[model samples]
Target: MLAQPDARAAAALLALTAAFAAVVALLPWPAGRITLGAAVGAVAGASLLVDLGYPGPYRLPAFWLPFEWLALLGLLFRAVRGLSDRRVGPVGGLLGLAAVLLPLRFSLRTPQGGAAWSVVGVLLSLLPLLGVAGAALYLRVLDARRERAVARARREQRLEVARGLHDFVAHEITGIVLEAQAGQLPDQEPGETAALLRRLEEAGLRALDSMDEMVGALREPGGEGGRDGRSDPPDREERADGATTRRLGLADLPELVTRFGATGAGGTAGVPRATAELAPETAGRLSAEAEATAYAVVLEALTNIRRHAPQATEVTVRVAPGTDGTVELTVTDDGGPSRRPLLRRRPGAGGTGLAGLTARAAAHGGSLTAGPGTPAGWRVSCSLPGR
Candidate 1:
């Protein structure tokens, strides 16, 4: 059965049409009028049946379709009179008119005679049918236009959310990294440098966690509500109060590596050799955006290794503070050659994985590069502004 229209306006229109059909069926009429009225009522009922949320018989006699014609005319009248605000136009109108008048002509005359009244009926019917058909076609065009508008609006909203995430998270992470770098200078006290690095890691990890939640909301079903609430003073205050203090940063990278290694411990990949080299100060200062970017980059790369380079026995992750104070993350695997390498892999294999990584990196004013490494393995690397 056809799915019922979900829009309130469409449902209301169907209900109104069904009511009109019932009235027409009950009205007094001559014998021929009674027959036509019954037919029209049947057609109306059938149309409304589509809205009852059940599958029914898929076919009806062609002769019975005259009732459908009448229903269409009713729809056209409703459309023109603005009684039904639905945009169904000339195509529906024409079909509806044809359904009514053509059968009337066919019934009035025998095959051979083709009487004058029959001809007149046929011709008169054509006029309304043509008008209604044109209107239906117009309405269809309008529907297409409306659909495009809605889609564009949704796209714009997503981009806006992406932009906000980049600005807030990237900026914060960059600051953290800068402070860590300053502490690394020879003149800075060792204790102070260590403390700064720890704080930076904490802040970056918190941002990363928050970003994951935000991204989840963006991908939420039906796109109801996923926006940056940071503009609200209360929300900002709460953020300042360190809701992210429990976040995981570079300091946690070793744990992440160990966890993955444990998962593969008994498998053919054999303990999944792994390493992490994130500078302590740099790790502490990472921004949320940078951290999130780094996390995603590592996650996707490692996932690709497991899925596509399952034979790889060792994986190495190298994260460092860049000369420009950005965070550079690289995931390299010493597995058998990639079945479908990142750079020149089979079409569909490379598209979704690499494209998502690229978009994530670009969103944070960074870049991601993935390809076959020099020593016959795969490598995924990303560089993002530090916190």
Candidate 2:
């Protein structure tokens, strides 16, 4: 531009510089669409000047083509990243399309009425854009998949915490309700009311324990308790026999299954045949969260079975080490009549028990699946790392 100090050359240089800067600075912003509109207007004006054969040394775009290339690359990237955000996406699309066209202005020049050269030039100029478009489209698809995965993970985590609360609170609340009903004995015997009050106190205290553990699980890591709320479970000394404070694990599953089966534990006589196949070596290796999750999985499955399939007579609980160093827990039951199907308790503030169990399993970098068994019944199976 300095070699030819004409007014037209100077003016064209100024316009091109401003156009390049505007494209670079404004295309990624909320008001980016305005920038694209201005660029289109500039291109239209430049085309008119060329048609009128405007005499200007700046007619050659050599000084600005590099700037356009850099801006297009940056704009294409922004378009890929911003596609998930509605505010910035449309502007990015328009800018990327415009960027591809800028090169065509120089490359697609054919002599007047030169039909064969014009067709070849147009094809040559447009071919490169297909590659750029393909890359931008692939990146957009990947971004969408990543967003969906993150959303799914968050939803599952919310349900897991809900399950922790539901499982513990439900167990304690069941006890409390039963105790309250027993306390309503019509004829008061000599110390019956006092014994009932003691039972109520125990039930209420268990509920408090459940609340603590669940809240601890919900809290952010390193700010409160360990993962799954109670990473350091109570030792044998801390767990008194027959005490509600007893720490649960694979070892306690037999008693839990028996309790669920016994008629006195709020089920029909001979509710089901409960069996266990827990690995003998799995007494202590599991992290607190994993162990707790395993227990919750079985508890919820049994609860569902008792509620949904009362006539199921055979249940198998298995805990074993997987070949891939994960702990696998499975609870399966033979088909049963749906006794009093509508009588099943409605889900509380937390979701249905299985949803919670699924969350818990996933939290441990494991998974849980409950589906129909080979012959007839249903199976709830899970695999998770110890940590």
Candidate 3:
């Protein structure tokens, strides 16, 4: 009752497997043995497929069935593993399917009893195959998840580096630019000019320090995400040389304002002297993320003022608790003309700083806005959620 075998379709694989089996059985030479061993799965799959389709009473030499069945099990395992690779996946899948379905071929020979036997045989074969395939898929899933996690960690590191450059380095560079401008004032005394140069050097040094901190953080394995899988803040990192870098936070606003005010002290007309009105309650209530964002908002505002409104006589930075559980930050400058004509706003090139701060604030459930002040000045305001 065996089904008619498709001799034409199965001929190639049959020949290949027979040739390999013959060499292993007769010659026993190392190369022939190695080749047969290396191709055992393919040989087994081919033998099974041919046997299933072979139109004869006596199957493919009973001696080969035991070896072929064992090898077919191995082939099934390999097929599951190969599914992840695009190159050999199709071939492996086809061969594995043939090998796995070989048991069902029995219904052709045994009439009524064969149907029940074939189903039982297929279910038994499937139990082991499912176990093997499940393990392989589980491992692959873990690997994919790990790759995604590493990619996410690296993206966060890059963002931290960008923020450090923008918040700290840009602030220092802007101060340097302002100091250089103050030195160029026509009636400035030599002593005052020398003092300005010193401040410029200090700002340059601070910018360099910030760059060094960022570079050290990048060089560390796992970056701000510690090797132990703990994610520390970008500001809390140790250098390769054992030096710790301190982050400038809300507490540092007074010093930041003083330095900014000093940058314009030597200028003749409407010299800008920045002031800070930081409320203790707001500072104490804000979370670390909100505090950092608030600090950046102020830093960026001050930097922009130096670039665009250097002649403003009054500049004020205010931080206070807003209605609800939110902290509000405002940096306002008395609208005045730019003394450094060279630093005049290039049309459409501004707002990049504010845009960056806006994104940073929004990431922590906060918002930012910039527009003309009540009477005559530019105003930048940000509201951030608290703890």
Query: Largest lDDT belongs to which candidate?
Result: 3
Residue 125 alpha-carbon offset, candidate 3, angstroms: 1.5
- Sorted on TM-score, highest at the top, how do the candidates line up? 3, 2, 1
Sort order, lDDT high to low: 3, 2, 1
lDDT agreement with native, every candidate: 0.54, 0.59, 0.67
State which candidate has the highest TM-score: 3
Show how many residue pairs clash in every candidate, following the order shown. 28, 0, 0
Off by over 4 Å in 2: 1-17, 20-28, 31-60, 84-97, 103-142, 223-247, 254-294, 301-387
| lDDT for each residue of candidate 1 in 1-387, tens digit (9 for 90 to 100) | 334423444434435544555454444433564443344435444553432332222121123334545655654443343312342344234325434444332333233323465556667777776676567557766777887998998897676465435433543444354444444446556576566667577658756875765564455343222234333331121223223223334556677666445443122333467777776657555665457557656655665665566556788898877767787888898765334422224454333555666887787888999888867788888888764
Candidate 3, 4-122: lDDT as tens digits: 54444334444455565444334332354454334544555556556455553333333344444555555545445434455235545554565566565555443433567656766
258, model 2: CA deviation in Å? Answer: 9.6
Clashes counted in candidate 1 amount to: 28
Task: Name the lDDT value of residue 270 in candidate 2.
Answer: 35
On TM-score, the stronger of 2 and 3 is 3
lDDT of 2 by residue, 1-387 (tens): 244436567456545753754555454444545553344334434433332342333335445555654555455555555544553455555555555444443423323334454345446545555565567777878888998998998787776556655676676565455445445536667786776677568658867877775555445445223333554434321211212244566777887776555421223323477877889767676776578778888888776665555567788899998766788899998765534431336566334678757876887899999998768778999897864
TM-score of each candidate? Answer: 0.39, 0.53, 0.73
Model 3 bad stretches (over 4 Å): 1-92, 102-120, 221-242, 265-270, 338-341, 344-351
